[model samples]
Target: MGRHSRKGAEAIRPDAAAADPAGRPDVPRPSGGRRRRQGPVPPADGYTPFQDAPQVRGGHPEQREPGGGWGTGPQPRHETTGGQQRSYAYGSAPGAPDQDAAREQAVARQVSAQQAAQHAADGRTARQPAADPGAMPGPRREFVDAFDADPPTPVGTPEARSGAGAAGPPVEPEEAPDGEPAERREAKGGKGRTFTGIAAAAVTTVLAVVVAGQVAEDSAGRGAVARAAGVDRDGSEGASRSDARPTPEHAVTRAPEVKPLSYGEKMAQPYPIAADLKATGKFEAVPGLAKAPGKGQKYRYRIDVEKGLSLDAGLFAEAVQKTLNDDRSWAHNGAMTFERISSGSPDFVITLASPGTTGEWCAKSGLDTTIDNVSCDSAATDRVMINAYRWAQGSATFGPKLLLPYRQMLINHEVGHRLGYNHVSCRTPGALAPVMQQQTKSLDIDGIKCKPNPWVHPGS
Candidate 1:
């Protein structure tokens, strides 16, 4: 501090003070006029001074001291955000302008205050003359957090605080979908963000797996369908001739190409087997039941038709039941009723089969029907085989005119053997032959010619 360190600015320049007419340091006068001060009389007491005592804050130019200059003083603290600035002066002397605390505080950065504080902290203990009680506060070091300072403005504003190089207008707080400030809508603890991230990851994973599965299916299906479809994915024809193939899901499905049958070709029109016909040995039993309607000992039987036979299996089954129970057949007087069955144990299986199939089954019983191409009872197995060839084509003895009776006699003879009857001949000449007779070969045995009969008791 100089000689005016405790006072306001030296308002009257040094020359003016020195050239006073009264020759006093306090009073002054003009050259051509009576000794007087500029515009105002000096007070009885000196004007209040702007203090600049060593190691102490300066004070305002309260009123005015004789010759006080700028120093420092107690300043009101101000805070700002985003770097805005303003300035003003308070408690300034009437005729003297000195450092103002308001102006000091309005500065955006307190660089001077920081330097002053640093000097104080470094133990610069040089003391100056005592300051007036009405002057600035006592000098002391202040330690604070080395926090960064910002000017006053809304957060995230686009404008530069210095008003230079601002690209656009300042930004205001954004509103959320619910109309609240976006900042408020944000999750402070990160819980919302965490949940959102997890959901996104899960969705992504699910989509990836689904896409992968579909890709795998398409890849696997492509080649298999190509050969069948004979069409390629690359718009070419034929699988072996093309590089890419269509997916199986897109492969065309075609119904079997079967020629429709006419009345002559339908199963209703029975087809004849060659005299030398042989067939698959597999058989299918006729399905369902026929109750034993008469009162007598009942016997359940199944009707089986060999596979590949061009004959009506139902007709064969129905004929067996109807013929056996006929008054002229073995079921005469209902000595034993016959029940047709598909399931459960049966007394026997009456099989209508091709000549070859019939021969194989008959051989199981040590019976030979191939010599005459006749039907036989395969007593060794569950089947009583009727030669389908013979069943379809009447014997030469009966001829086609007697075809029905011939078929009836065939069933009666074979099944009769299964009923514990042996072959017999007609005793009385011109009488009906025994049902057990081998009529398929010759109705007249040993020249004892007899009428054809298909009954246990010829009269009954």
Candidate 2:
């Protein structure tokens, strides 16, 4: 019984305070047997509202809503000091979820406007220019950085700067500043452009070869033209200096014993004489002289010995034959014969007489004579008339002991006369006396002897 009674009384102990719908207890009621109604309590932080409120973050309660141009909401407060209950009604439109979203949009707009103003003050546009599709962004950045940096000393003029471009931030492009991509540029035309040193040089070489060929052809054509016009490149003269007749002044006394040589080797070989007859214009070879004769009679050589002459007749004949044979020039053309007569049918003839009687005999017979000797002509035929009478015995010039060389010279001189070479005075200064000169008596010049026997071969 006692446990049941305590349960009823304690279980029925009046609610200490009535709870509101929020599950919080209501304020205490007054004591006097009459219950007192409680008013709204302050927030836990003990905040209060000012009596003459400065302002509300969002204007009026009716306007604080979406699209209502609202700003920040009012500060939180309580009704503690009997000031009118500061009801900060963060309002919402009929379809609005809350007032916070509208406030956020308004703040974003303010920030945008402030940025625009700042950009304008800095003398820059709010929007940047569009980027180019084909430009070098790296070069652009480099250009910008360089532009902002301190300027270098002026290179030229202010007009130069005006012509130059202005600088700014980099604007990247899809392509380079060279106008096109490397691949595109290469494909533009079928010109086949390529880069190479060796190949280019080869092309240049080919071109050079072509040009040289053209130049050579042109030069050849010009030469043909000149020839057709009768203009000679070797001057207007018909003959070379080598073709002219040479004089003893430039003759070389060569040894007839010089061994034969080939053409090229002979050109290199030295001559035995003191002078180079070829270089001095006195040397000549007459290959045509050995050619077949057009005359009806065969060419022949005759040596006529004067009767009672001191020269050995056989030696004379043999010497002449040997000299001619050794030279090969004169021997090729004719046959030689020895004779003794003042007149005969021979092609050539010689006469031997006493030195004392030589001039008398020629004078009596009506013949031409030299200072030391005489030469008689036989009206019958052309002849080599040698008078050995006036020569001193055993002398190089002439003697009873007839020198072979002297006789050869005489024969050559007379034969030359027969061949149309007249007696011309020797002109070589300090030279050997002419083979034609009367060395036995003539002393026209000092320190000079008779000309070499071969001097007439090249036309003395």
Name the candidate that leads on TM-score.
1
Q: What is the lDDT of candidate 1?
A: 0.60
Task: lDDT for model 2, please.
Answer: 0.38
lDDT of 1 by residue, 1-460 (tens): 0112223343334445566776555442234422232332233345433222211225322232322221112211111111211111222222232223222222312344434444543333345455577543432222111111222333221122223224321222233223554233332212333334445544655777677789889987887687567876776886363446665765778788998764223323334778768988898989989987667778889988989988888778888888787766666776778889999899889998899988888898898889998888888898888889888887887776677777778888888888888988777778887777777878788779988765666665
**How high is the lDDT of residue 15 in model 1?**
49
Worst 10 residues of 1 by lDDT: 79-88
Residue 428, candidate 2: Cα error in Å is 2.3
> What is the TM-score (0 to 1) of candidate 1?
0.41
